[model samples]
Target: MAEKYRVGIIGRTDRGNYGHGLDSVWREIDRAQVIAVADDDERGRWSARSRTGAERAYSDYREMLEQEQLDIVAVAPRWMNEHKDMMLAAAEHGCHIYTEKPFCRDLTEADEIVAACEMRHLKLAIAHQTRWTPTLDVVKREISKGLIGRVLEIRGRGKEDARRGGGEDLWVLGSHVLDLMRVFGGDPQTCYATVLENGEPVTGSHVREGNEGIGPLAGDAINAMYTLPEGATGYFGSHRGTAGDPSRFGIQVFGSEGVVEFLTGHLAPCHVLRDSSWSPGRSRKEWVPISSNGVGKPETLPRTGLHGGNVLAVNDLIDCIGNPEQQPKCSMYDARWTVEMIAGVFESHRTGGPVTLPLKQRENPLTLL
Candidate 1:
């Protein structure tokens, strides 16, 4: 904490605090103090200023970035539409960033966000906090140790919510599921997609208008599969069903010896369990707590050290800047596959054919993009 990093937070009290835990995370870092606050809504700005008590208040995020000599900027906005612009400004000033999830709304913007940060030699860490949970850590360790035996196959899905309706589940929640897949499968060699909204394909003629914004993005579900470099096949489904709609968000990993079943997100009503050939009493297995620590030593910060390990992502970004020699465990480039994973599903639906990734062309078709 010797080298304190000044920060400016582009935060909103609404939008459920960006769903990344930054509202409270800043309190844990003695070395990190928010020096400014900004939001388009005046009330949101007032709330941010009162919460962080920054010396300066702004209604425009770009203006704040121009004035504040910040070491880091936390983009904690509710929607993904503004992330590209917000982040690029931060990178232009040579500041690192901690952005909210789904990274960006589409592949076109996703690439821009990554390139903007990389061009400035800055680190970009998405708010996929489950990557740091204690339960998830155990799962990763077990997978590395072959606890699940040969690591045969993997699968996961999302429950319903307000954000559930859009075919963008892949963008919203699929990022988390796909990221976990990458953790186990390494880089994917090829990808295949199948998409449905309420179990139907979306076409250009059948425009979808959702996201609380007018557009053709409100598809209902996204389902896709990928072939990992190690020959492991992985699958992910982001269905916008209902919050309390008897939905389960978790991973089912099959292996020769055992299996690791992971529940997605740190959200409430979580039911994480594990099963294997090794049997038990009446139930094949017992309920296991889900958690995640640090995977690799991506930075000089103590393994699970920064942000007191609570906001693992924010801490990881700090460690990335503090220890430039070490690469972050997650990066924007590492996340493109996630976009590819979702887009492939849409492509499959749009073209009435199975979509492929490592796409050969690597082009985006979303006209709005």
Candidate 2:
């Protein structure tokens, strides 16, 4: 019989709680065993164990790691504060990691965490499961088939809802947007952005600490642009209380022949507009839906709600763990570039010019403001 992967979970109820169902999703994986769970809060630990059917629970994650010989761990807390430390601990214990989004506070944190995982030969998967969703593969295949013609530009936006806008919006919602831009446009070569608050450019006074230990942040509105390695240009924008339409909070790929607009969510639908003019009334063609399996109506998809993405991500981790040469869809290296994209926006604003890729500023760019 094949070995069942021993898995542990780490969470903090006070800080985003079990990270969008990371604890429970492992239960769905046939080859995974929920061996133990840890959370700094006593209630969180108990709740996680109860939900996951974990064999043991602890209030301190380090203690759990030291005691359990885990093959994998879900660093489930959404809080950035504990992310770096927890991943480091798991790497030292020689366990693979599956963690939440917006991987860490800054490029510096991403660098260290990735290094630790690499040195230990551990596979680290971030919870950016949009990358794993098969529907996206369909979208990419369509793009390559000239459905959108020669891709020329990419546009993206954050949730920009009332709950969190500006800097918080960028770190939280923008991570997904920026990563998607990379998917369509390739690695960014340079970035130019303007950070704003109350319709004015953000200044040093506007920079402040972020929620859930996201680290220093600035601006309530952001307008950024990037040059993709493929020569396509990418744009990202967000503002407070600007949650226009849920469908609008996604990426659009423009090509010389047509355009593709993608909605963000689990198995989110993508549409193709064949009219090169882009303007609706002026365009000669209409928007049509693309599916994971076919070209028309979306297929009946799995129920991949909040926890669903985690399950898909975990499955990929398990597969990659067994095949050392294969990389998970949302690998640690991909997460680092996402962080760099976020930081580059700020660095561009600070420098009053475009900031080149692989940002020179390793720390949180907002801190420098």
TM-score of each: 0.83, 0.97
Error of 1 at 333 (Å): 2.5
Best by TM-score: 2
Instruction: Give the lDDT of residue 188 in candidate 2.
Output: 93
TM-score of 1: 0.83
What is the lDDT of every predicted structure here?
A: 0.65, 0.86
CA deviation > 4 Å runs, candidate 2 = none
* Model 1 lDDT on a 0 to 1 scale: 0.65
Q: Which 10-residue window in model 2 sums to the lowest lDDT?
A: 301-310
Alpha carbon deviation, residue 355, candidate 2 (Å): 1.0
Candidate 2 lDDT, 1-369, residue by residue in tens: 238999999988888788777887987999999999988788777887888999999989999999999999898888888799999999999999999887999888999999998898889888876787777888898889888689999999888888687778889878888888888888899999999988999888988788878888888898999998767899999888888764478899999888898866667777888878887787556788877775677678775756667778888889999988988988999999999999998999988999889987798776777
User: Which candidate leads in lDDT?
Assistant: 2
Model 2 score (lDDT)? 0.86
Model 1, 162-238: lDDT tens digits are 66644655566667777778777777766666555556665555455546221246466666677776667888766
